[model samples]
Target: MPTSEFDLIYRYFSSLGAGPAVDLSVGDDCAILRLEPNERLATSVDTMVEGVHFPEDMFPEDIGFRAVSVAASDLAAMGARPIGMTVALTLPEADEFWINTFSQGIAQAVSEYRLPLVGGDTTRGPLTISVQVMGALPADKALLREGAQVGDLVYVSGTLGDAAGALAFLNGEWHPEPDAAEFLLQRFHRPRARVELGRELLGKATSAIDISDGLLADAGHIAAASGVSIDIECGRVPLSSALNSHPDSESKLKWALSGGDDYELCLTLPEEVPTPEGCTRIGRVTKGQGVKVDQDIDFTAGYQHF
Candidate 1:
């Protein structure tokens, strides 16, 4: 007997949908969510296709977690508190082992991000995962990309380029020490979304964005929206020791500048605002257009799917 979609949902995903904000979860036509009167809703969706967003051979668990994390990153950028999420999973076939393992990943993300699985769909097709995350933001305060002003200091949470370095290692571009390789690979597979830090920056940050498309490109987004130029001091960008172990200065810097998938928040704060822990001051917003890096290295404006 072949398993049905409803069976799959009941067997693996039904229990993952319990949260304070979720009035109703799986096994229903629609999930019900509640928000406080002082709160506004924030939502975003992200899609990941096999062999594009992730390697075809990547573990099912990692794929599940990555999908949720990537979608939730958008909420982090808005300084919102996660409420619930939905996953639309398309699979070539219903392999029980794969489904079980993938569900574990989703469960892990749900616990880590405090985001419950609300409702979703399953269909037969090429392997793809689309995650839609919903969050709640204070009615009077929410981060935007258009508030950066000249003289605001630019900062980024956590290290950059590790995921890009991991990609390079996977592609056989270069091989580092075993320890470095392990660290980089994990960084790529399980990039942390800066949700807490984003919430902490609520009233202090002038503008913000997550570094999904690399520092230079995402910073350009803030610049374009805020009508200012961002000047990045290449020397000040943070890099992990694992990425620094690559032994190529130019490559390291390029990855830091143009490598995507870091998922760290890039934000602008007024000079008087106290910097948060684990954040490094990288540059400043100025009167101009686009982004500028004070380095001679050559690179494109981050990853493009077109």
Candidate 2:
């Protein structure tokens, strides 16, 4: 806990700008992000803190990466390509070492998504980081979670429940990982934004929302927003191998159906839309409200944030 300022930067923020997309990075007053002049900008912001959004002792580096990824995922949900980002830091103290590690993680994430740091603010607080990412898309082609009709196919990207399972492991509910426990653990901590997938779905998906919450809960958002009914098939849920192998798969499934924070994309598309390789066909859209799984799994009563 008693870390020095320089060491914090060296450990946490130093490895940033290692990737090709990072034209400029931390230590500068502002970073310059490059993009085609004609591209439109799509942007979003997310903030996390020591205790409010994560464990108090969560690594500062993971916190940094996640802060950016969450906001970027919103852009991805809209079918935009990432362009750049601004990071705002409110810390309890000026721990340079922590900031450095955080910067590296942010840069690492940006490397994956191709957005570099463009600008930001630093301040004093209880270890809070807010990131706003800027992305680009055609003038009028962002995907909204409101185009599903009575017969669209409900699709989801990537497997669900890994983050929730990781959280369970963190809370001591279980242990996981034969070959990549740390990787899965990092998923909950530093999840990647599905920008590429979102971009691919631009012309195909009728409706879409990044699944920050469990599939059921997020699909419900689309249902409510679009004034349609969603049928989320429990059997069709794209669960990770680790999740299916766990002893408490049912409860884990429930968690995936209710718990948020996965940050993947859930979409509704015409049966004709050529879904990308990894996307799963989970269920259907019907003539009513609420979400269910083949008429048997009721998700209308899923998690509610009070």
Candidate 3:
């Protein structure tokens, strides 16, 4: 690890911020950005702690990839396109090789998402990664949790519970076939943010939220914020083939409903609008408050910091 922060930034971080939207990048005290006319800026910050968020022994590259991907999920929920991001990294003790691999992973996500690295800080401390993402959308187009109306249909993108299934494998509570294991493990490490679908849902979805805190709890957030109730049909929630293959159907369903870190979007739309291509209709918004699932199940809402 390099002893000087300036040297580390120049070598590993500066080049990641070289896109056109960034007027000032890593060398400066703060990032200077240019937002297009009629566009609104959207910013979100996420922090991942060692052991709690990820295993300490996990690959350095995966840590970097998951950090950026999870942070960008917020933008997807808001129907905003990412412009740039700043990573504030805390290191217990820097390792040159680890930093290189981690930066490679971050660079990969930055390239794929078209998000430039802007400016941030690096300091010595418990292992943690905080990423602040900036995105933009046309004025009045950003999706909000408060927009869902009564009778709106609820939807979720992609399969749920695969990531939770992966955690089960890691915890030795579940054993899966090799192919299924690979798919589930990949889901845990690399979550795909639904940026394109979110953009497509703009002006269409009445309300939206990213499923980071489990499907039920996140849906409740929308219900509470919008002053309406949401009812999800457990039978209708989509599960991956990997989850379906597992023998314990009940456990799989529980994981799908209450397990966090799915990073998929749960949205509500008017009944007249056709369901988007990749999303599955799960339930509907009602006149009451709180979230209710059709099946009788008991579990915590999702991952909680406390």
Candidate 4:
């Protein structure tokens, strides 16, 4: 489709609210923002495309949630609490119904994270969503992936592999109860960023990375960034009942290791600090390179984007 002209702006993008920090809203030539004293701004943007990030037939709400969650994950990695957002969408057609549902999901996320939608753009193209998020934290407290010390303990929040299990269900390996199925699919569709935990750990953590990729891949990120080795105890990964009830825990563990899109935070904490509520210590940062799980531990390979 050719570029959409200016008239469609009001048709789709005009109704969004311009909440706090928005000195000038959309429809203006510029935007202005104000930050509280001593607050440091943290920003992240992520783009998702149909077929690459999600299924073509996925409900619009899920699409909206996933898009924003991806960006929120980045903020969480930096231990920032969200402040506001701008969304840019490109679609193949002007589907009012889809847009409405999508906006509802975005609104739900905004409320959930206590952030507001300040401004953005809407235009014509293949289905794509680009969300830019702004967050803030005290300058001394922001988390960094490079802050890990050799003796720090590694931890992750929530369960792993449920999203991968949902993909299996989507491919028809087996059927599950609707609510049970929904839980797994929800992880894939609208992963929850560990923002609350991130904020809680800001000054306490040595290093952190959000688990957008599977455990090994993301753990590897922490290892590489911090210049340390990570030894994860495979037995410690928290599996949702979804993964526990599966016929094979080994396969589930493997999937947990390699699957992407978990969106949970994988962090390094100085061993002296007790693990926070809701965080599981899955490993320790070491002196070598890469990630190591027990040799006997095994599961499906992590997400292979290629």
Please report the candidate that would top TM-score against the real structure. 1
Tell me the tens digit of each residue's lDDT in model 1 across 102-186.
9999999999999999999888899999999999999999999999999999999999998899988888888999999999988
Would you list the clashing residue pairs of candidate 4? Answer: 214-259, 254-299, 254-300, 255-300, 258-302, 259-302
Number of the candidate with higher lDDT, 2 or 4: 4
TM-score, candidate 3, is 0.95
Q: What digit string (tens of lDDT, one per residue) describes model 3 on residues 68-122? A: 9999999999999898999989988767888888898898889878889988788
Candidate 1 similarity to native, TM-score: 0.97
lDDT of 3: 0.88
If both were scored by lDDT, which would come out higher, candidate 1 or candidate 2? Answer: 1
Per-prediction backbone clash count: 0, 14, 0, 6
Model 1: runs farther than 4 Å from truth? 1-5, 300-306
Candidate 2 structure quality by residue, lDDT tens digits, 1-306: 333543454355444433343567656766655556676778788877777788887887788778888888998899998777777778787755666676777877878887766666666667878888877788767899888888999988888877877777777767776544565687789887899999999978889999886787789989998899998778788887777767765676776677678888999998777767779998889999988765444445553321
lDDT at 102 for candidate 2? 69
lDDT per model vs. reference? 0.91, 0.76, 0.88, 0.81
Better of 1 and 3 by lDDT: 1
Error of 2 at 302 (Å): 7.3
- Cα distance off (Å), candidate 1, residue 302: 7.6
